[model samples]
Target chain A: MKNKIIAFFLGLLILSFAACKKDVAQDQYEVNPVKLYPSIGAKNKNKTQEQYVSILYTNLFQRALSGNQLVEIIDCLESIGDKELGREVLISNFMNDPQVVLPSDSVMRANPDVFTEQTYERFFVRKPSEAEKTWFRNFIEANPQLSAEMIYFAFALSNEYLYY
Target chain B: MNRRKFIRNAGIAGAGAFAVPYILPSGRLFAATGRQLAGHVVYVLFAGGVRQQESILQRYLDDSQGFPWAGNIMYNMFNGPSPENKIVYGTNQGNGVEGGTPIPQILSQTLETQGTVFREVQAQSAGHFGGLNNLLQGSQVTTQGLKQKPINPTIFEYLRRHGGFPASKVWFVGNGIGNGLPLLNYSNHPNYGSQYGANFFAPSITFGNLGFEHLSNAKVYHPENELDPMYQMKYFLDQSFANVGKGGDSLGNTEDEKQDIKSFMRSTYDRVTQNAIPFPTITENNDALNIGFACEIMRWFKPAITVVNLSSVDGCHADFTGYLRALHRADHAVGHLWNYIQTQIPEMAGDTVLIASPECGRNLNHNPIKDVNDWYAYDHSDNNASRVFTVMAGPGVPQNLSIGNEANPVGFTSDNVPTIGEILGVKDEIMGAGFLQPESVSLFDRI
Candidate 1:
């Protein structure tokens, strides 16, 4: 009788374990998505040198938290309202799950040293090759309307560039 | 014989009634509703540690670069200095304790006349959180036994409660440094504590107990008892203030103590809560420029109390790629915001108060990595962070006044709450072993 009772108790414990595992797996599939959109006039349309530079300037001015720039950028694009797509298209970008690990603060504490092309590629936006960043920097500078200082500031402020 | 009789008849009630009329509980003078502004506050939480060697102080001492930004803005504000400009160029004494250089010129020439400045002349605690807590909560507490939560209610609460101010009346915004909500002190409120709705961020707002109306209505100030970072804080504060009565909580203490409790609860609770305001959009630019944009936008809302945390200066301390650009932009933003405030809110132009201070000092030592004063560790523990420069000016304030004595910039504790309270027309209420014990009278008194 004692042996039969012990075996019955062990079976009950196994059933409880199975129930807990199922509960844990129930919530794992949930995904929270962040929105992204094309640049205001970039709806398959090429932008002017001035217009592109302005976009770059806005991006540079608003570094890490670039989403907030949407309101102002949209306001400026009012002249092109007829050409505009849905307003929400501006912020419709696919993002890694918010939980994705990024570089630690200790690694990027020194703002200049940490913001290299390789660092950007590893953590933030897809890493543009150093050559590409340099090229973009130069392009921004040569446009007399914009200066090297302005291009450098844009990169510094870009959310794609600012955060890991 | 007649004089002796008169003296004998002089009762305690007669003498007491003759004391200060301000002490008496006359008819409640509730604030006018139209006079009320559903505005936001842009407090430049200038951290601790500013020496006369840098910025404006340097300008006064013939070191032109000391206050480059202030110099540029002053030049722009006024076509040129008139005879009224009492710009005194001088240096702070050699002692390190006496901040680097003293510039009475800027104070007199620029701040004093603007009537937008609010200077806190009486000094108090000099440590980082010590000075900040005093400034933010309007009460000074010691560094050793600091509570995890605010003991004395904050200004955000009081203004919201008593004034029937909206939740969006006050805001504590930053340029996406991830510091989260600036003041989580309201977490102690029964309806709003740190755990229930501690932070004013997206995640916290989405899950918290705060009403959905606040979430839906970003434009209108929704008065509710929920934990939307924007709404609940204002509601909690406003309600606390409206709840105040004269006869309650005498606490069997002296008349002064009774007054202190009454004032502290009424003012601190109302100001902090009533002004739960909107967060700024972190648009493209340096933190300074972002702060400037928010400050300008906030002028439209006209928050009664605003805390504009300029994060870019911290960028300057790190000497990032565009540090100087960021700093210059920040300077420009301050200038623009000041111009807008003066032009748009003519009522506040003279009556409103403007205060500029730093959060903490940077390492004077040039080295970035090995520099002893990096974020991980630095001089603040000692007195290195003790010395900083603060400027204040506004209506009813004295012009070109220096808090430090003539021998030095006036030396007082970092507990400058009394001065702030005076400017806002609230009495200095918090009192205790650590809180801002009103040492000198109003900061307005120095004006």
Candidate 2:
């Protein structure tokens, strides 16, 4: 009787081990990867106020910047400071002011590493005119990135903004 | 790992989730591939700076003599007979162009037969390039310093990649100005050269007509090198199964490598042949070029997106003597193309989504003759120029939607992507920097 009891306990242990193994195996399979990136809501909660402002400015400029929004952009730039040079390069390129002029030809020469041959030409030909020069300068002086974004935003607002 | 071993391990481990298809399922899979619902896109760029007044709307509701001839025509066509003689009367308040610029008769008939969908697509830029970029890219992005190519990919690229279409199947036909390197050519997919594809023969050879024979000749002579690099890539991906027989791995294996090699071989051949052709000629005449391309597309390769860019509209802005004629001709081309799509590819007729909008709204401030150098140079009228008219009609779209006073009616411009995406049952991913997705008000919703 004792021998029978020992056999039964041993059988139970084996079964339990098999069951655990099966469970672990089953857990391994997955379908349609759970998204790698977290949702915007979750990500936003962790960002600092400075980060938030940066995102906002980046987002706005990335669209298009118009002459009208120069003042607001200037304010944003003053707040962001000088550490951001990549952004500054973009701003300086756009300003084309007498103090910090980046001519189209020079810009073409500078952009070999960044812009493709075709893209560089298309952009160079359509430079911002003399009238838009001042607003561009003031903003570049205030902000870090040339905010090439203004053109896009300006275009969008120009088309979307209600005139009446 | 070998696919069989991988599968076995996966099954044994119950890692079925990892085996799930990696593609973000574009719901259009069940769609018919061949001639079934095989459609094309017709872009109607009503150039010649359309004025909100005299074109579509009347200047004053009270003044009887205020209505212009164009306004009277629009009222008669769209609004029909009315007691007040105002076509839209009370309905079209605040929607610019009070008198109503009646769509040319040809387009109207085509719309009626083939089914139509229309929207007042919004744009961000008022300038030609800016507006063109917005429409072509379906959104706006900073074109300033970085020169990282335009952020908004054209519909052509989106359709080719996400829409399960071949690049060769898309056609870009230029009107009046013939064809030049399209300013809107920054797509992430293959771009057809003006000299090749459907319009193989030049004007000198074809006698101002499309040389249909040349299409066959071109295909036969260059059958091995028909597709652009992107199409070659896709075809390679499709035939990736062929590599499995050579005792190679499946996932990241020799088969995939072979496929890449095949694509490269095909691409190199195409690049050489494309450059070999004489610089493609630009023709001012549409005649057979427009109609013939339409028919061939319907009969042979049913393209997903076909852009018929009418340059005469821009010509009008230049005060060219025949601007009106060009406008009329563009109207006719649009009409003819619609007829062919409906009659020949009847399935496409219903399923197709046709969008007719101007590249940019013409300046309301200047007349073509008055502003010679800046004739068309009405600095972008903020959103006013962006508020150009768009008419859409096709399968799975609504007929008439009263976009009544939705504060910020997201009509027109790049918002078109999300709207188109909703119709196509895919995620609208072709967003530009700061391109907030337009509120997806699909034609399906109203229809």
Provide per-model DockQ scores. Answer: 0.01, 0.01
TM-score of each: 0.43, 0.46
Cα lDDT tens digits, model 2, B207-303, are: 2212111111111112233222223322332232133222111111122322332333234234334542111121234432444444443444455
Docking quality tier of model 1: incorrect
- Supply the TM-score for candidate 1: 0.43
Estimate, for each residue in B1-447, the C-alpha lDDT of model 1 and write its tens digit: 598777766765578667734321211134422232112233565533432323433222122222232222223122233212212211234534222222222122354345323222333444445555555555554532343455555554444333333433444444432332233324244422222111121212211112121121112111131112222222322232232311111112222322332232233223324532122221224443445434443544455665554544444334322232233344445555555566666544654566655544443333333212121212333343444545554445455555552235442333334444444544323232133454544444544
Alpha-carbon error at B419 in model 2, in Å?
Answer: 2.7
**Number of the top-ranking candidate, with DockQ as the measure:** 1
TM-score of chain B of each: 0.52, 0.58
TM-score of chain B of 1: 0.52
